[model samples]
Target: MHRPACSSYLHQLRRRLLLLVLLSAISAAQGHADEFIYNSFSGADLSMDNQASVIDGLLRLSEGTDTKGHAFHTFPLDFSNNPIISSNTSSVPSFSTTFVFAIISDYDDLSTDGLAFVLSSTNKLFSSSAAQYLGLLNSETMGNESNHLLAIELDTIKNQEFGDIDSNHIGIDMNSLISNASKGAGYYTPDGEFKNLKLNSGEPMQVWVDYDSERTILNVTMAPLPSTKPNRPLLSIPYDLSSVLPNTRAYVGFSAAAGGIPTMHCILGWSFMNGEAAALNYSDLPLKSIQQLRAGRHTYKTIIIVCAVLLPTLGIAMIVSATIVKVRMMNRLSKSRTTDIEWEREYGPPSFTYKDLLAATSGFNDKMLLGRGGFGSVFRGVLHHSKQTVAIKRVSPESKQGMKEFMAEILILGHLRHRNLVQLIGYCRHKQQLLLVYDYMPNGSLDSYLHTQDHSTTNICWAQRFCIIKGIASGLFYLHEDWEQVVIHRDIKTSNVLLDGEMNARLGDFGLARSHDHGADAHTTRVAGTWGYIAPELARLGKATKATDVFAFGVLTMEVACGRRPIWVDGANGEPVALSDWVLAAWRGGSITDAVDTRLDDYVEEDIELVLKLGLLCSHPSPNARPCMRRVMQYLRSDAPLPADLQPDNLLRIGVSQELRMMSVERPMSCPATTITDLSKGR
Candidate 1:
């Protein structure tokens, strides 16, 4: 009997699984960390053909050394390989990410090390970190044995000898130590060498984790070290990412819950296959169950045949659907608000003839280049239209988010026309030609004055600085309060804030910013934005709100007052007194003079206190406690005594300030040793 395609497919899948088992057995001769699926966080295939399994994990997106630190999110991969961070996609879909999670750490206590994979059906963001899961529970120290979080405990050393699990074990948690979801199933997971893993060595390890949105299951595997091969399997667990998907976006990454028994685990790298490659439903399927596979050969053959057909059919369906989805997604690119210009209608960004920009930028030459970001380069160009000089942001389109972000920038910026926001002049809407045009800022960005640029602003005296700060405040106020549609400037770093010839601060780079409103900040899923300037709330809760932006302003205001970047601080040469901490301390000591820009030493004590107070109030520990932009202006313009009690100590206590030494994102940045594929090769 030919039987239906469904039965045939099930048989095929079973056969494939059996084949894999046999192949794995034959290759058992190899060792761990041998088969590497190189993931550099560049926009590419998540699987990399590595065939790694996932338990509970997400991808490692490189944030590229923001002012403070960086991390990435794991998500249901989109049709275009971009993780689906928004819920605004096709509903007729099954979401699954390949590879589970294993957080690597050399620390003895698991609670001391922190990590989590946030799930949100609403907010398309994921958040995670190694040392401490910052502010997750709000009222408890890390590893305090009581919190509302899930932890993948990779305790290298035994702290809880009386637990039902082993030292190097895996278990499900609900954010606290007292209530473990794992039954008697926890045990010491042995690596290929059968040696105990040490998370305190400051060494890195490779872990595989996967999530199925349809079935709500998670699977995991781990190697003692990064890229372990030849059966590097350590532990595996079935989980449901959708269980918490309501709380976060589809992007995935590491997250940790800390309590009394601190431990450490780090996710060295990660990836998730685009929209539902194949999910095995163990509850319903006989083939997925190991018991069924180990059954009689006749049954096994039937199941294998079914699986082979099912898997191939599923793959083909996914490919076709994903292609159609991509075409549809690319078809309705956001229309330019003002379409009277024929140039935009005919040739949009990434498609606009590069030759035009080449002539404008003088052929991508260094002199015309404006600057570089985590994605690609920017240039200064003059459009023959109106013969006006404008800035061109030329992205590599290879960075994980290049294409989508380029489109987003074009869409949102094209519609926005605020004096404080950079205006989008035009875009090149081609697949290979990634470029954007904006009104040029001859003074460069705020960073040029604070750092990077060798020349200080000859025009920016104390009054100018105050004006600049107020200008930035105005722009921020527009973004947060005034705009009809509230926009969160996710990355509010100095580098992102531009300056006109008059030194007026204008917010640039809407690439990371998102539209958010009240009551939406508490459950953020995809945690993004520049580090350092990112609010403490973002670190604890992935949500970005007006208050979150306010927190960043606090960090930014500190920079403005000191004329320095947030990365540099007053102390922490040895002690914990960072710039923010010291500011509070100084305020408390009644010597608010210490928070002034050393250049402003000549200024009166009261003026310094005004700026210092503003910075401190913005940096308040509680988001609710933070004053709004309107109130902030009232305080800045009028001498409101700075809050002596405003809390800046929390960030320090949570170890967020000591991020470099703990997380140390300053490792040498790796780039393609050389660029081989030059689009300008034709030239």
Candidate 2:
């Protein structure tokens, strides 16, 4: 930690060395370095601009210096290859003034080399300062740096200052790191004010430096490439940036010091601009820059004009075009999509275009598959121009899930977004060729882990299982108790719970769900959901409510803990037994531990019991008697007490006990893409 702090201090110390470059960037933004091109390898032509000196004789490629001493002896600096204009006025805009350089180097040896962007009061090069080595210090075989330059070196080799943490990178320098280059080892304005520079990187790093000589303000924009927009230059820095050069009329250049070996890199090309001091400090200007900018005043004016005139006209045209295209696309969609869908009651039959889905799922290639559902297959494809990957539910023409059910789902799910609920990225309505695009979940559903043979279930240690439980609970709690329109996940099963890379669970596929509010009655619907997980009360009154989901979740939780299918034909000992009935009978007999999975022996005995109790709560036969998923989570995570146990005598005594079978697909459910009709009453 202490060494880390020292490095931080060193970072702070070294940054001040670039105060000259920072200040020059600022000054140049006001048109400072415009006079000399960075390629002036010689010291004669520059007017103390960025230490930019013009050298008539640099080590060209053919006339290279392989010697140990006087190392700037030879390199390919075709005056044409690397040109910077010296003794010239810079017409570069105040906000736009900057130096650009292209550099290429073929190394002779790891000669301890680097290139520097220097901003100094003296334009003279090959002079004596820091040992008078012309940016190359010492009479050694490797490298050298100059004392007379305030430089920003993009060094390639390790030095005595820092280590290899930053391999082949950029740095700031002032004189010799001795007294003359960086006074006080910090930055300070001539008037005693303080400024600092911050550095970070992105790809294809583009650095924008701004210097407002009026305020002696220096700022830098350091970012790698690929950002959507350029970032702001961080100012009000972490270190003082004004103490590099004692004089204002200094030159800018590069410096490298090598004692043993030689390292080579070069400035292949260069650009320069002269800058004048701005009246206001660059830091103080909120109007963007000294250059005349209309962004501030014209922002709303331009938008308002577009909205008032162009927007309405475009909107009408767009609407007309959309109507015509919608009919055609819908017709095309009907051709490919099967009519075996249960359209939503309110929205009528789904009208997704087949061509749109074709485009979205890349023609339903195996690669685009999302997952297979009880009804049909889900595929991932992009919308035409949006290029967005949507989960396209292609209802099989011969599937059991009906059309109205799909519509019912769409009416409810289309308007949701939650942290634990997968985002409904977009949807399509092509006659029967229904399709939907959601924010893709590359990580498969929870079933992938819990039921996989690829060493998945065993790896889901207690921590991961706990997280999945909590995530599913949060999502269900949102659907059940949080939303204004209370959503009831009629079918809450492990397969519908999607998992992200982090194993965060997203409760999805609300095909058998229902929604209501405080003022509304729970809806009456046929018993729905997976065979082993549907609430018992659902088969009787056909009423679906929030408790229904809680029951399903409870079943899922138990399956997770038990590490077995929800139902089994015979007990391990060869007796007829349902997992739920077996667990209940044992609970009644004070032998609930019999229901816990043997594999969970490492889990705390009490934790297993807690999970068993939750499962019982879900398997409760009466909808009115079940606790909400919210309470389930509270009991799971918090110290909340469980509700009193319900006696088995009265549970589901009157429902379809005489004869009820699962797979009662009453309402025609459409594909997960077009409609959510699966939750409604059966025929």
Candidate 3:
């Protein structure tokens, strides 16, 4: 009987052990089902579209100009059935994803387009377009709510239509090409300072995206490869995934496109899971893929080997060549040193060597030319010492009076420091050549976007235009009242206003700027400014003051709001009509809001009316009647209400009628006797 009992106990023990092992196996299987990892794409199960291919264990999304590519997982994943939470809730389950990527371009400081990490309801993006659309949507499908798509874009081009902040930035999108929220591509340091990152640097970087269902918050964090992830996220947006997607099942992948310039977008590794994603090992990633795309590493090694073999054989020849070259360089250096010393004695700004500027601008090649202005032509260059990109303005060599304007720019911009003011890096003088260096603005002048005839390029939206207006006002306020000396920007127009990499308005072209001590009258003897931007009193007085700058700003305000030049030829009868006069007529006709840009799809009517009315107020003919920059800021920021007496009839009584009559008769008004014949010629 005892033996029979022992046998039964042994059988029960064996059954219990088997059950435990089976449960552990199921748990492991579920974990494996919930996550996916790709250390290499050589033999990975993926669905690829045009231009997307896996070669040598690297995933290349786009490799040439005017190309679009898509790569998605072969199987869809259900996000609703998260192991950490129940599936009964309406909110989508939380998830995390991490990836490593690199963008390689042929040029160092320029790139055409970028890439995106996408999550879509459908596996294929058949209706996508290339270029600024990022291979995610087309004109017809963009902004469609029924698309059920979400994307995190790493953009390298500033597309005004979509309201991109700058060329290099990261943005979050939901069912539309326009990002709902965006930030410049950068990461925060441990001390909380921001450091900008160049997306097309051809160096591997890691990105982490985590969504918390409980808080409905999505955090995006990025850092260079081999470094631990930063604690602070680059962007944290509050949104619900359910609102962007019809269901919890979706395909995850990457999409990229190139525009007119050659660029290659690549992905090295990726991992995704319902919970935290598995950490990526930098050692295991294909970091050399970017270098290979640029020029094969083996090719570099071969060059190094050939140099090693030839160095000893050519030693005597190289010694003689070096001595001869050194003597010539010494002579050139002596002349440059003499010229620099003379400039330093006369000017307060720092100076750059002519040789350095030449190398920076590639000997001022035509391809590096940015634009020609009334005073000079600007070139994009990168300094060798700091690798900092700059804009070098080469003044016209034929102008005998160019020295005066060049000195004015140096004296004024050398000491001024403001976010809205263009920063003067230094100056270079070589014989008749006069070059002024400034921080490079990648987006170029504001007029290009506002007045371009190409309808193919999207117009800047109302929001961006309004922001630019406010920014210019703030800069003017600083110049007039906040600085040590009162500054009068003799020329304040759209062409003089440049946009930086982040699309912020920066007042440039200080060649015509003038400054005076507090409470001192401007002693300028010649009037200088664009046609319609010049104040009526300036032509008579031949003097520029803070009020004259205000007048120009007013015209600029109207130009930006109307999306027309300050002086444009009427399409109907070929008569030049001033922007301010046209806007004033609209106000008198009780259709002031109609003066807003028609290209704008949406706008706040109240804001539009306020801007129009304020512009007219500032453009008042009498200098004493025009509001100062301080008051103008108040009006723009809503800190103070506009004067109630500021009606069209009241304005007409205060010389608005005379001003309109003069503008109509003169068409493009003439400036007081000055050097520039047609102020708009070079622009």
Candidate 4:
């Protein structure tokens, strides 16, 4: 009887121990379900779109120029409840995420837009754009509260429109590209010292982001890879995510974009949890994968070097002899043929053979022609070697004036690089035909969208128009003040502003652009440019200056805002009404916003008023009264307030009244006699 009781007690104790072990295992499983760790994305479950790919176990967000990429977690996380929060507290869950990323670019000091860690309601961002938009939002959706988005951006480009602090920065974005709070990419040490880190250094770096629900605080920390997290966070802000994330479920992801620069954004490791994220092991990351990718580039460089050194000496001698023989034959044929070699040596841009250009353009077929202008016809071409689409402008062989314009474009655009400026790739000359190649703009000219009567093309919204206005201003600012020399864009109009694939404005047509040393007098004496865009001083003095460029920009601004050309015949009276005069009249009548593009039904009233008033100020008859491009940028960005004395009466007192009165009857007295007609046609 005593032995039976002892056995029964032992059985009861074993049953209780087994039940406790089962409970512990269940709790562990629940914890794992709420978190994830990806040492490498080789087999990780991720939703990718566009250019995003998993290459060599690395999660590459973007791989090439003018592309956007997105990668998101396969499952959504519930943010409605927090384990650490009390019943009366907010429902938004506290979370932490850590990731190691790298930005590799072909250039050492330059890169396109950067990447962002995003928490969005949906994983599909198909409508997002590349470049400064960063694949998170487009011009239409940016800054809208309905987005319900939260992002931490590591931006490598400084966009003034978004109020970026610098090129290398980490910002907290709430439903917009404009950051709520931003800091230079850096961290403070334990001893209260700050150190800067370059985001596009082509090296791996780690970032940590944590949110505390109780305190409603967000902390972001970063450090170079393989280093311990700094004690102090780089950016700490007191904000509630509950407002930005209205939905209970959110998908975490990464979005990146590249502009004209070739860049690669990659992520090596990632960890995220509802609470504190698990620490990532540096050694476990797939560092060797990206290393090998970089090594491949190095191998290509080595091959190029070896080829340069190992060229057969005998072969080189034979080639030199053949070149001498060919030159002798050409000399015997005609001395005039030697001018081609001299022209190539003087203008130091890459030269393409005539045969290659002919092949690229399919022998200049009519179907390949993009548009015809006064100077030349532009043809769309695909280069055989690179498979790159380019615009080839073939100058008219018989037109003596076309040669001057061709040389001007080559001398100016070949040496310039800016986001808003069309890039000149190379030049070619065969017989009497002059060829100039430029990066292709797919969306065509801004004039087509603004003034086209074709129902097929969609009307540009007010947001896109505003963006184009700012883009043109930024490019003009770069030309007038930022560049080494002062460049006066003699022709600044809707037709000259080309829209790229993303509809970003690129000021092209530099045939009339004149550059001079800073603070030196302009030597250009010819009064050139379209009729309405020509400045008053330019017509009288036959000189181009930065102020003249501003005047034309002002006219273009009002034209864009009002959705009318600078000069259009009034329907009622059949008399020509200048765009500037009409806008000024609207301002005087206390209905300036009414002059805005009628096609646009939705827009910020204040922005419309600001643009109209700024246009008038810039178009003032006296060049001295006009603000510089720098001040214009500040006014557009609202960094500085418009002048208190700026009014229609004040402008009238400054002689604009007389000028407009003169210009009201079809053509003004100051209009240049040699103004280019049909300037609105595509170039």
Candidate 5:
């Protein structure tokens, strides 16, 4: 007789639970020394600092007074120390700590300074420092590179001189008062919602700081007092502390200061441990929980029995739920791919049902197809509700890179509001199908007007074309230098440039866009962008710099002016001639106007010649030789003069030939040599 399926499943689960119980019992039997330092400040033995008094069962680090003072608590910090913060060649030690702290304002509704948990090589506090400096370091000591210090600041007062986010923020500082990474005071709920917690509420709050040295990931979790620990952390950031700290030995203590609006800084229970130690949970703290009598020697027995019984049931429940969800999703995906209406309310964007899109485009008929790209296909659609025309990009399921591009478009374009940048209205993520909706450009991509034989129908006037050029320059300037960070539009071409209702150019398609820190040396191993648009140096080093984006813009500029693709076949010799080379050759021959599109006979000769020369200058092979987008904009607007040495030989030979000769680009010797690889192709 064969065993029943249900009984067989339960037998397997029982075996797994029994093995888990045995493992738990073994772990419980093992004993280790309690090497952690913990203090609730309930006894007369003042360990942290003699100056810090135990007042009302709390450690008072500072009083709300104007008089400057300093205090520090230190222990034997060396290799022999139990909880020493150490860094070695092999691996850095990990630690976890938790503490309850309160910063009370001296004046009504005002707190002047803040407090910090500092880890330093020395035990001494900066005596000259107070208020804004937070008693950590003085001006002279801060300027020294050897002043190795790391601090986690719970700031209650804004220091305008130091560019703080606001009065309420938690920041990680290295050597200086300025924060390396910071965030406004908030705690995350289990449902992923952020709840703002006031740091100056006068009420104490619990903070848990954990570092996994192996991963170099630091997490900060916080919650209002008397509340259970938050399942999610407020801040989880990556930082390698070993690289910044001086050595294996360091002192860890608290520092506070009083400014014009003085405040009291107090710490109520504190605990610190090293070597992947776990801190006491917030719910288990004496301040938050009721004391319960424990039956001697049965703690391990009770935990094992409870876990063994609960584990199997919990595992089975989870499996059943997951199976049901998968079945339902598959059914829904096959029958009707409509997105839930609740998504609009949840994310604060107008929702377009997948069914409505199907109806709008007649089930994605070929007639509705506008264009196709590496990631997805764009279709013209009309919203049935508003009857408004729109362009929808249906990402291909097989395109693994399309999902990233879809999300990038939503994140970048969703918030960016610009006259020259395309607007992202809404998006849909239903199973494997991803889609993005944007305002329809009836004129279609600029590539069709420039390269295709359909130019006769579009017939873009030189005035409009010049405006398009200036418009693109302004857009590139915004992305490269104006916005908060340097947004490198990795793919910039005539195809990505869209025209609006008034025939004004709008730079669209930010799938390959990357926001780089200003003044930071940025390099990406995963090189992205269209082939011809990618910069020459990118081929050698595989780094996407601001210069790379400028190079692409230069190519697009030439393409718009000459009404030709970056790489096109010559009519006379049937040889491929890069637009940049053709323009440079024409300029050398002393008839640069001949390079302008023949359709633009009514164009101004000098203006056309200026644009052509600007293109060559921008698309220069040398990344350093290329002008920044801001400078390019100025030159285009006539606000700045072109260089005196903007001659053909000088711009082409030194900037192009010399740079190209050393590069590994596909077409190395070709003027403006380029390779056409899709952004999705791996480097």
Candidate 6:
């Protein structure tokens, strides 16, 4: 034993002597055809930004316990002396880098956001804000091809906005802030065994990144301490770095961000080469302090080693115990004594924890609120798992009726699927707070554009307005007849119609909807629905039927056509007149074109007359007089001719008398004879 120990000491001394000679020669060649940089942080030249500092001989990019902030540190890579590889350059070069890092958080019970290794044209820190943006790129630079940047992110928190694969993973980003691809964090052992690693476990890990310009390929490798480098890289991606990097050199660094949960990202050591392939001597690395830190974690290491050895022996028993415990816990959680838990189980959509929402919505800040309604207030948030932008509705906690309505909406929309309907993504319940998640609609409700007096920012055009009408009709048709059961939408108004990214309408607010069997006499005593849009029969008899929904749809159609509310208060006389009554009187007097909104300068006059006439037919006093939703949809699409009986003579019958002459002089007959000319002028 004594002879072996002596031999080992001599070998270590000789290796150190050889490393010193090799490093001297490497330093001489670094300024010319190649470049190399290495930092131990104990006493090295490292340029840290204002948000970063050197703590305990390690570079700390973010505060030890700070949350909702960003920090960055850059290396002094002078482009004038050492240029980076680029497509515009005469010869694109290859490079490799190795880094040792450790991530830790004050709060261990909850995971935290993490850091990234970046190469960028600008040396600025915190180019983006905190949270999912990761201090690398902001909204302006995201997905911008001109922003020369490349990053390898070791993320510990799953932010949906960044498209994180998991809570702990490795991702590759180019130009854009969001990762193009990512994989679960792990390492391969010498025996080719795979071991999952957690970046936020407060453990140190070593990483290697190599770029080959010839093959336009990039490779990333990782390993836990006390282990040698793997024979093969864990992740090898084909990337044309020359296209992304600028002709000028770039600044290399690390960036970290935190939101509700903070993390301390530290770089214990780093080494990089920018030119030709040079042998890496891991033995020459300064790792005495790192070794000491690992020694302190012997207890955890021993436990992990023992577990790895006994995994096969105890696998079946552990699986059985885990499954039994999981089932019992799920049952208990889902069957709790509250109605919320029952709704959660019955709906069975993904359930987000209250903490997750708090972070996503920035502690439910007022700025995050999208809008408010009678039942609840809606807020916008970015989900951590997918980086998806979502709208969250929080029901009023004190409203017992609102709670019932909330449950009713979930039950109605959970199983329904249609492009013209809002999607129910998930929900959250904590103590007294109840929240529902939905896909965000960029354009707000239809009421905003038609009623708001601000036409300057109004996004709806004449053609889009017409399409919205047809889209709403399609949704109502589905609710009333296309689905498995008949659904009566007690409230059908402009406010209930939401616009998607493409400005197509999606009928929402199903709290007042009721499902029943077709051909069954279904009646409700509940007095629900908006005032003017409510059918006359529903108001007097307090009954909800398919015809009642059609009546409301008719009122909505007039509102869209005239760009007015269901009830209009005349400015000239402080008297309120129902919009349907005013339009019907205009049609009777041969002045119906005057009721059309003058704001719409570009529209087919014939289509306007048809919609006005249809509105009057559907809003007739008798529910049976209204056309079915299917017939209304067909009329809007011009798939079928209007019923002769429902078509009032004043609207269709031409007498060729003084009345016809006055109608033509007022609105002008720009229909069949002038279709091509009018459409061309409008376009």
* CA-only RMSD, every prediction: 25.0, 21.4, 13.5, 9.1, 24.5, 16.2
Model 6 stretches with alpha carbons more than 4 Å out: 1-341, 455-459, 571-573, 647-683
Q: Candidate 2's residue-wise lDDT over 144-224, tens digit each? A: 232334444444333322222232444444444221211111133445444332121101222344544334455543332
* Candidate 6 lDDT by residue in tens digits, 225-315: 6466777777888877757775556777778765443356777777677753343344544455445544544555455445544543455
- Candidate 1: C-alpha lDDT: 0.50
Superposed Cα deviation of residue 129, candidate 1 (Å): 49
Error of 3 at 378 (Å): 0.9
**Please, what are the lDDT tens digits per residue for candidate 1 over residues 1-683?**
65788898999999999999988977763321112232333342333111122222323211111100123342232223223434643321234333323332212122232333433222211232222232133223334432224444443322221132433444444444322433221213334245544433334443444444444445444444323332433443545443433333233333343222222233334434334323222232111222221233236445545554464455555657577666454333312222312333323313235677778888888998777766789899886533568898888857768766776676555545455678666666444557887889999877667653543443356776677777777777766766545777776767778888778778888886676554454334666765556566566556778888887788777777776555443343533234566576666666766666665534556666677667767766678878888778777777454456644444234444654344334532122221212211110
Each model's lDDT: 0.50, 0.48, 0.81, 0.82, 0.69, 0.69
- Higher-lDDT candidate among 3 and 5? 3
Each candidate's clash count: 118, 98, 0, 0, 1, 7
Model 4, 386-428: lDDT tens digits are: 5779999999998776888889988887656577998777788
TM-score of 2: 0.45
- The per-residue C-alpha lDDT of model 5 at residue 585 equals 80
lDDT for 161 (candidate 4): 60
Query: In terms of TM-score, which candidate is strongest?
Result: 4
Highest lDDT model number: 4
- Of 1 and 4, the candidate ahead on lDDT is 4
Could you tell me every candidate's TM-score relative to the true structure? Answer: 0.44, 0.45, 0.50, 0.65, 0.49, 0.47
Superposition error at 122 for model 4 (Å): 2.0
Residue 78 local lDDT, model 1: 28
Q: What 10-residue stretch in candidate 2 is worst by lDDT? A: 59-68
